[model samples]
Target chain A: MTVTAKIDVKNQDISESIRKLLEDILKTEIIQAILVSQHLPMKKMVMPTLVTDPDHLDGIDPLAPAFPVNAATIAARLTRKPIGEKIAAVLRPCEIRAFIELVKLNQAKRGNIILISVDCPGAFQNKDYLKFAGQNPKEATLRFYKKVMDGNAVEVEGVELATACKACEYPVSENADIQIGLYGMKTDESILVKAQTEAGDHILKQINLSATNEPAARQTAINSLITKRSSFRDEMFLKTTETTNSLEKISSFFASCVNCYNCRVACPVCYCKECVFVTDAFNHDSFQYISWAKKKGIIKMPTDTLFYHLTRLTHMSTACVGCGQCSNACPNDIPIMELFRTIAHVTQKAFDYQAGKSIEQKPPLSIFCKDEFQEVVGIND
Target chain B: MSEFEPTIVAFFCNWCTFTAADLAGTSRLSYPPNIKIIRVMCTGMVDPQYIIKAFLEGADGVLVSGCHPGDCHYINGNYKARRRIKLLKEILPQFGFDSKRLRLTWIGASDGIRLAEIMRTLVSQIKELGPSQSKLSMVI
Candidate 1:
């Protein structure tokens, strides 16, 4: 049986309790640093900060609605080579999933990291978050979490959750070594903390907390959220498919692309060390551009926008964790996440694969067998 | 009023399918002139980008034919190619490229007659399917 415990809440401040929990985790002798999102004091922007001293935990707020970047990329950086010390990372469900994909790609090592995920309430896009936070980020975070925990609509002010978050089905991470539960709990009383793996159990043993059982209501709450999100996701898939079903339509869908390539940079699973699109290979000869323009009668300058997106779909769709960072990073406001997730859903399902589900499951394209997918072979079909 | 001769780009594996094409040519087994074969070391090296580039540049059909499963000169290149083909079939169709426009086959070096026959059949099949969408409209 897994160990489940509760951290007492005073003044009904769940974030403060979680901060204290992390502070305690940081105090543990085995842990060298704890990586958690913090409101950087100067700008108050929520970014992942590594903390070695427990006193630096004041600005830590993993519950904030700000997701400027997927911390999986950061986690990959920390664990790419052994840091020689154990670190605990507090990540969202999607970040953990993306980190898992990075681990499978051999970009990240899990040997010295403890993954601690909470019941993700989802996050807003970067622009929407800045608007939502306005002058008081910490207060806005408190309001956001309270409204979400109250089981009301996510729209607090004029802003709603990012489309990607609304359509996400994974509100709870199953792969986390330790999970902090907030949904369906009496947050005024205490929050749920459970050790899901042997690593988590080892860490939990070091922390002094009273044991408790997970409330039956937690499962029900998670199920309802999943149902709501799945329906939204199905609707999104249909709409995205309609908009991008044809090549012409897909081109129009990305018509505003300036080839900034910010989306790929923001993507945690876009695993290339250096993308070919940015390399000199795409720098065509003057005559090549002239010929291309002459052939089409008029070619769009800064060519290969559609080609880039399609190539990315082929390369990264199977590894996509539906983090929606692509859409967040788009300067053109392209619904890149919808297009990617719709295609990713089909691609992953075609291979009977779910990206980031487990480290043990090899990436679909990495390994092949003698007798599978024969339906794709032969000219007769 | 003229007949539509679809342009097909074929990536034939150097050891097996490319040799088969050469055999067909020397043996006077006439395959349609529509197929422009690019010999590669293995179908495994025919990255998805190459196929996508062909389609985007208005090639009506793409074929990657290599050694049979256990007969790969590289001992598993054909298998890897099959997985990539399967991936493309899943991805390309989502954006309205008829999945039939792309094909994967296994034709051994000695199967010259078989290679020529399959090419004719593939050309006819694509001809019936009409020109690919990329050919009919602007891709970018």
Candidate 2:
């Protein structure tokens, strides 16, 4: 028989309960260190914090609206080498997926990190979050939770959640060892707790929290949320495709790009230590520039804008996960996420693969299949 | 009047296209002095990034010439290059540059005349298209 568990939130605060959970894990040596989210000092923004001492978890608040960066890259860095003891790291669903991809690429290790995920309520962009917090952070956090648990999308000062969150289909972390459920539950009542893997089951058994069947209301809430997000994603895909179908149209779509490369930097899977664009490979001599300009009569300053984007698409499309961090990081607000997600959707589908879906699945380019794309190759004999 | 000349970066496989280019020179066949060939062991070693980098560094066009599909010196390098170049063709144009600026062809070591003909054709085509400026790099 499957077991479900609940925590009564009416009698206790969610943040305090989470702190206690981490404290217990720290004291028991299950995790040598714990990484949690905390509000920045004198600011309403939340950021990732690593804490080895349980006392430092007092200000940890994972429920804040700010998602300035994905925590997967952090987890990858933390586990790049063995640290002698396992560390527990909390992340959102997308972050966990990104981390898994990084691990498969040999950029990270799983032996030294404990993965903990939470039922994401979605988050706001950084600037909007600060405005929402205004002069009082506690009230803003309370309002944010109320809105999210009530199934109403939370907004920060009228700006909606980031496009990434609005279109996210996975609110529950499927790969997490320990999952803290928040969606589809009463904010004033208990939250659900579950173990998804052997590691999680072992930890839960040690924590000794009695299991109970998840409430029917919670299941209904979760189903409705997933359905809502799925439909939104479908609508977005259609709209993006219709707007830009060909290369010329897509180039116009990105005409505002100044080649800041923030999108590349923000991408979790773009792990190149030295990108070709930054090297001497793209540097052109002054005479070459003048000669080209003289020939063409005009040139776009700081050449190779289109080449830069095309190079990145070829290199990173296979690993794109539609996180929208690229779009979030853009100073020009280019719809880079939409373009990448659209192309990646088609490319990955053509290969019958999904980025970051499984560790066993090799990237399409890394391996060759004799029967792959036979029709396109005109080898349909 | 000065003749229209094109600056082409030719990524030629050592076994075939490079030899064909050398054969063209040895046969004294007249071809446009437009192409500056970079010899690679196999066409598969010519990463799409390298082609893009060439264009970014002011090469008006790039030609990736390798052995015939079934005749790659490295067994399957030409086939792999074909797949990669095909994908690059599909994707490069989306960034506002003409995909024609990047070309791929097969040339055997015996096909010195064909190599010269391809160079002449590419130089004329690039001249017609003029210099590639739309795909130029942007400084942050």
Candidate 3:
């Protein structure tokens, strides 16, 4: 049975309450470690940390409103092999989805892990997070949480949340074992936590928290957020599709790409031991470049940018979770996510597939039905 | 430009479609000579990259032929190819290339006449569509 519980809040510090919960969880012999974002003494940035000791949980900050990396990659690393013990990981919705994709792809195993996801209030871009965070990130997080939880604009000093976050529709994770909910809850009095899986229920029993039913207001709040984000997502898809619906336009759309491949690195589901783009196949002969230049009069110096993206589109669209990390990592500030999400939306729909929807759903390419897409094979009756 | 003849790239599977093309040649069956056949082990082995590369390299049309359903030498290779080609067709139109430029056909080795007829039909379709824009680019 799904168990709903509360972690009472003190001093109106949501992050501190979360940290205390993690510390309590870590202090037990139940989970060997808890994966979370924590402030290190060396830098102001909150990086993913594996807290084996209860003392280390003091720096835990899942509400920092800064996403430097998709923490699913970290979770995948922790869960890839049999590490002999389980780990509790606090992640965002996208991260859990990406981790699930990794598990499906055989990049990670699901045995020794418990996914703890949050009601993502969304995050700012890396630089913008630093600027908005100012001197004390803890206070900034509290303020950020207060603003977003109240359904106000999450903008700080004219800066706003990252485009991916603003365009995000899936703010609550469905695949997580435990879902921490700050949305539509009286956070100053208490925070809501739902044990979404058997593992989550077991953990709540161990913690000795009283059970409660999911509040009706939580559902209403979540519905409104989804409605707001879906409109944004559809508008983005239409704008991106219109601009990139042709070869010349697609080329021009990616014209600013220097082929640095930051998007590939940032992509969570783009797990290939040897990427086709990095192989000797793309390394053209020096004479071939000169001949191509001679033929076209003047070709783009760093050619194959469009080809690289198209190849990725063909490969990963079925697995893309629309996390917006590609645009987040682009050095040239290209809205790479918009194009990918646009095409992925169409491609997935054509196959009647949703990438990373659940572990039970097989990837579209990996399975097939006898009667799907008959028009492509000219089988019209 | 008035006498434009489309250069078609045909990826024929070694087991079924390749033999069918060979049978057509042996039987002296007449078909368009525009096709440049590249033999592959199976249709499943035909990467979507090859199709994209063919278009990028200025092929007016592409035809991928393999054994009919339940006749694949590799059990379900043709089924996999069907799904991949279907998705490829769906995406090419978004990039301004007509999905008609690519065709996936099923021709058994015994059906040499069907193979010839399919080739004629594909060539005529391209003739109606005119040369692909990839071949008519100002730089190309």
Index of the highest-TM-score prediction? 1
Best by DockQ: 1
Cα error, candidate 1, residue A29 (Å): 1.6
lDDT of 2 by residue, B15-113 (tens): 999999889999999888888999999998988888867766567888888887778888888777766676666555544457678888888999999
DockQ value for model 3: 0.54
Better of 1 and 3 by TM-score: 1
* Model 3 Cα lDDT, one tens digit per residue, A1-381: 667888889999888878877776766677999999987777789889988988778877899988999988888988888978889999999898888888989888776898888899789888888888888988888888888875547575677988788777889999888888888888998888888889877876678676677788988999898888888889988888899887778877887899999999999999997898889998899999888777647677687777688878899988888787898799999889888888888899988887777998888888888766778885222
> What's the TM-score of chain B for every model shown?
0.98, 0.92, 0.95
True contacts kept of 1: 0.83
Report interface Cα RMSD per prediction.
1.0, 5.2, 2.6
A357, model 1: CA deviation in Å? 0.7
Candidate 1 Cα errors over 4 Å, as ranges: A150-152
Model 1 chain A weakest 10-residue run by lDDT: A149-158
True contacts kept of each: 0.83, 0.16, 0.49
2 or 3, greater by TM-score: 3
Off by over 4 Å in 2: A1-4, A150-157, A215-220, A242-252, A375-381, B1-10, B20-38, B51-83, B86-90, B93-140
